[model samples]
Target: MVARERIITTVRPLDENRIRGSFINCSKGEARRLTLPRLTEIDWSEVDFLGWRDPKAAHNAYLVTPRGGEVIGVALRAAEKHRSAVKQSMCAFCGTIHAATDVTLFAARRAGAAGRLGNTVGTYACADLACGLYLRGKRRPAVHNPVDRAPLEQRIERTLDNLARFLDEVTTDNAR
Candidate 1:
């Protein structure tokens, strides 16, 4: 049985429309066509952000994160599946160390024309994109974290900043 993890902070759950509307790079028709994972199937209390990969659309992943009382939706493309064993792993977002199989790499299409021209930026992230859960200790790291453990608030701030930087990269203005 999966251990039930508890969230330390209060976070409001989001709906499908809010999730679909937050995409910075995709067309409305594209967003509308994708299926949302069953919200009732998720453990909302343990998730800091909502995330899922569509079973029917393996290349597609979705993230709905609440930032400053507003939910932001990100449409993502997954790297082709590569499974292997490694000695150490650190999530590029939360920086938590885990088993190599627990993290996966993803590339986000840049917004607007840049995406049409095929520009994308990638990051190695928690397989489930549950950095917030790892930060709040709802998910535990499998390996010793190499970075010095700072105050919870400070770590949370850094993690959030990491996410913002990634978002900037996915936006059209930062496209390369």
Candidate 2:
């Protein structure tokens, strides 16, 4: 049996330009305040984007997504969850069902004054934004798979599309 290397490099890590320019509402100051994750902290072979919660700002989260050959970073405000835990939850971007504790509410800043005016877009996202990893099977869910499960490639594409759609939403509001 030939041992097939499962992961091909479909995604790349983001550079400073990609990270700074990724956000619609982030001020230059805010972007400057942003911290990049250390290479040691991530398994680059598995992730499509770089995402993490701020160590200094617990309610803050960040994501950088790649399109074509370029990347964009998004700033998000994570909403607090219930003290009580539940058995099942769903990740809005990846749409994978998970334990309630696995999903967290993430609010992205609106593109313009709507955001400064206190308007934000939110979703129940995987706590680490590791949906790509989950979809790619680099990571697995806490539960068993559905009998009617789709192909792995299809699931990865779907997750990527979902993220692109969310980025479009952020950009669309920026155009306003």
Candidate 3:
């Protein structure tokens, strides 16, 4: 019997120009000014999205993912106060369990006029913004859950769904 190879849907590798052009929630100047991760150091096939925290500015994080066949980026800010590590938190994007200190509440302004008017959306996510890596088993959390027996594909789909929903919340104008 032959073993079946797993099919993975990996995000395409992006150039700095494409990444800098993908932001939907921030000004062109802001996008240009944001620090970028080392693109050359990444293995694009192992990730479903490109996410990172700004090393120069601790509170700033960014996510760039493919949506509707186009790349879109969003700028996020971490909450000033962190929850206690005694409580375990599940990352809404990847379902990875983490000590509360490893997860954070990040807020992104809405796109267009809504954002200009101060509308924002937020979610609790892995503090390092490495949900794709966590879901793929490329990285491990401090505490492990042996009971989450879902197949990798299913978990990937769920994470993608959660991400899409959050992106919609950030880009959609609910006032309409």
- What TM-score fits each model? 0.77, 0.79, 0.90
- Residue 174 displacement in candidate 3 (angstroms): 2.9
How close to the true structure is residue 7 of candidate 1, measured as C-alpha lDDT?
A: 26
**Which has the greatest TM-score?**
3
lDDT for model 3: 0.86
Q: Summing lDDT over every window of 10 consecutive residues in candidate 3, give the lowest-scoring window.
A: 1-10
Q: How accurate locally, in lDDT, is each candidate?
A: 0.73, 0.71, 0.86
Which regions in candidate 1 have their CA more than 4 angstroms from the true location?
1-11, 40-48, 66-70, 83-86, 144-148, 174-176
Task: Report the C-alpha lDDT of model 1 over 12-109, residue by residue, as the tens digit.
Answer: 66677877887777889989998898876777766656767778987788777765456667788887766665666787777888888777788888
Q: 143, model 2: CA deviation in Å?
A: 3.9
Model 3: per-residue Cα lDDT over 1-176, one tens digit each: 22222222568889999999999999999999999999999988778879999999999999998876678899999998644636788899988998788889999999988998989999999999998788778888888655568888788888887887788788876555
Q: Least accurate stretch of 10 residues (summed lDDT) in model 2? A: 1-10
Full ranking by lDDT: 3, 1, 2
| Among all candidates shown, the one with the greatest lDDT | 3
Candidate 2: tens digits of C-alpha lDDT, residues 36-122: 677566776677667788888878889876664556677998888787646788887777777777789898877777677766777
